[model samples]
Target: MRITLSDLNTKDLATLVQRTITTSDLGKYAVISNHPLLSELKKVYTEYDAVYTKSTYSGKGTDVASADRDRDVSFRALKNFLDGYRKMPSLSNYQFAEDLYQIFKLYDLSLDKMSYSSQTAQMKKLIEDLEKPENIQKLNALSLLPAFNEMKSKQDVFEQIFAEQAGANANLRNMKSASSIRKDLEKALRSYINFITVMKDVTGWELFYADINELVKAAKNSTVADHEKK
Candidate 1:
């Protein structure tokens, strides 16, 4: 019944809130349906979702955050693929996986902690390292050349959009960040969960608690799976 909600990333947090709403409706839990907290949850969820969907760029430009996310995913997928591939002795190219994986270990792994510009610089250097002839040969042996190419593509796209909006971003007003909005939505969810925990013994409240608790568990499991996959 316990879920460490704060541990979830942006994507999974939205999924948790969304699935909770859907589950509450599916069971037709009047206790939840009538609650003021449910209304508040819906309101905050909408606000947070809209903020991210509509990029921070005031005019027509691609979202820098999304492109950054794609690059991050692509890199992690390559790293994780090597981690698994290197462990398989049966594969003739397993030696290549082990060699290329050493290249990744040479750099700092916490790309997300860096500022956006710093992250871009770091990715560019990493891509340069990966595209070296020695690394390219090993990557080809493991059939991972395309994965590196895709990561480079995402990095290139992010770099382009970021440069395009650099001047305009300075002029745009400071808007509420998606992270801040998410905190408000999470608070609404906590209030609803707290109320149900207190009232579950009441006539029709038990089922509502069960349904939402299950959704909470599911979200926790999903987050675990995502991390493991990476």
Candidate 2:
């Protein structure tokens, strides 16, 4: 069956892109025997293979690296691959895939690289905050009410940011801005926002906290009632 872009999920798309690139690289390597660039390509491909093998053995197989370190390394390898391919005269103008593949592949890799970088930075902040005794105590004592309230506020902010940025991007695309050659970016970002919003709603902070509070209260009440009867 022919797989269209709309048919593939995020993971599937990522895998498709990685496979396309890897296959292209291998084909070029085969054709360009005794090429000086072969050594570097082999080294990079070896690293990619190692990462792929490790993830498979761990039963957490993913095409795009999910972990921060591995993701960074994979992206670097991809970039190196692209750069080397550009330098090869023989591979020039070799059509690997259609424009959709070109656009989405670049978008996927670039967006993921940025997203992972941001997430890594955020994790560092969270770790720093958690390491502080006072902050840890404060977090430990967090009640359902305050926690949910804060989460709700943050959710609103996140939604607003997404909307504004999306609108601006759409406008830019419509205006045919120099940087707006990739029209699919706007669509991708919109879809991403929808996905994130649905996820947040499904895993709402308020609802989870309320459920935990109800469970704790029921346990406490059961204990007290048993003691009174005794």
Candidate 3:
């Protein structure tokens, strides 16, 4: 079944996007063999690594030099990985899923310092703030986190696309039975995995490529199963 953005309810779409973004590895993108950002960051980090490596060699004996060189290599690798955090791709004018995915991934990383409860409270407050019409305008005009921001920024857009859009207070709902709803959900998930493959060639996110490939394989191989009742 073909699934467009309209096929998903805003809440479900938001949830899916949030879940995927949080789990993605943005630092891995910089290791993609051909990414421009990787090339750029490589030059910067190579110079940095050279300086640190030289420091390890100063007045060091042969045995110490050999061991220090090994340590230096490991240190440089860690630096390269961490550099990706500093060089996170900007989110402005992001038109592709890969781009948006990276943006959301980075934004989640920024919240790592917060406790779980604080993070949840902040997210809840953010959602409440976004529900206002004025707040929605602010979101669209400003550069916001991809999934979280776009959901609010495009709330009206979703409404226009989905003719039978579900909401907290939709009196004339497009009611579907439990089975049909489940089927639609399954189809939607399948579509998402298929979509990921289409955009999988994206660079600057190599760390996440393996995980995404695994997700695609799992999604494709998964079958719907009935649960036994006690």
Candidate 4:
């Protein structure tokens, strides 16, 4: 369901933050923890609930004038509302984004250890299988391969081809020599690098958020918007 951040309770908001932290790669986490925008977000998240409660429930201090009290109340509400915006990207696409992140991590962390080149025939079969409508449908349903650019989608397709090919190969059913493994690893690495190269414009949280935002926007402008129009 489409949701705005203000729609979530403290518990839900915290879950979103936790999901982001847990799913992120080290590079992504660095951005979340260190970037000025995201650092401020973490701070606001830590204190916003308490501040919202105080602003809404507590009376003005005795020394405050009535006019100033109203102004202060307005300002607090506005600030709290703005803070909620931080949760929007997560609320919209955390689950799919997590899946995509997992796929990337599988390649990033484990790619080098793979052994697919040894079973060229089986690897080709596996790639063909992945190209089937059913497998492609599954990925499409998750909205993992956004058309941010043609190159991004192409990278996704090729990476999946490499991964599935490796996994499906009978010869690679067991581990291989480290030197033998390097062949498949290098292949995977090349695909991964190509994918990241296509995405060179952004990195870390910025890149992560862009993926979700683009997918969400596409959905909203399509069926979601159409439903609203009707």
Top-scoring candidate (lDDT): 1
Listed per candidate, the RMSD to the true structure in angstroms reads: 18.5, 34.7, 30.8, 34.9
| Weakest lDDT window of 10 consecutive positions for candidate 1 | 53-62
Between which residue pairs do clashes occur in model 4?
Answer: none
The superposed Cα distance between candidate 4 and the true structure at residue 21, in angstroms, equals 4.4
- Give lDDT tens digits, candidate 4, residues 1-115: 2334333334444454444334333464454345443443444444443332232212322322333333334323322332343345756544444443333343332232234
Clashes of 1: 0
Question: On residues 109-154, what C-alpha lDDT tens digit does candidate 2 reach at each position?
Answer: 3433465446444433433433366533433343223432343344
At residue 3, what lDDT does model 4 achieve? Answer: 33
Worst 10 residues of 3 by lDDT: 221-230
Worst 10 residues of 4 by lDDT: 55-64
Residues 7-70 of candidate 3: C-alpha lDDT, one tens digit per residue:
4443443344344443443544434335443333334333333332232212323433343334
Clashes of 3: 5
Can you give the TM-score per candidate against the true fold?
0.49, 0.18, 0.22, 0.22
* Candidate 2 vs candidate 3, TM-score winner: 3
Count of residue pairs whose backbone atoms collide, per candidate: 0, 0, 5, 0
List residue ranges in candidate 3 displaced over 4 A. Answer: 1-175, 216-230
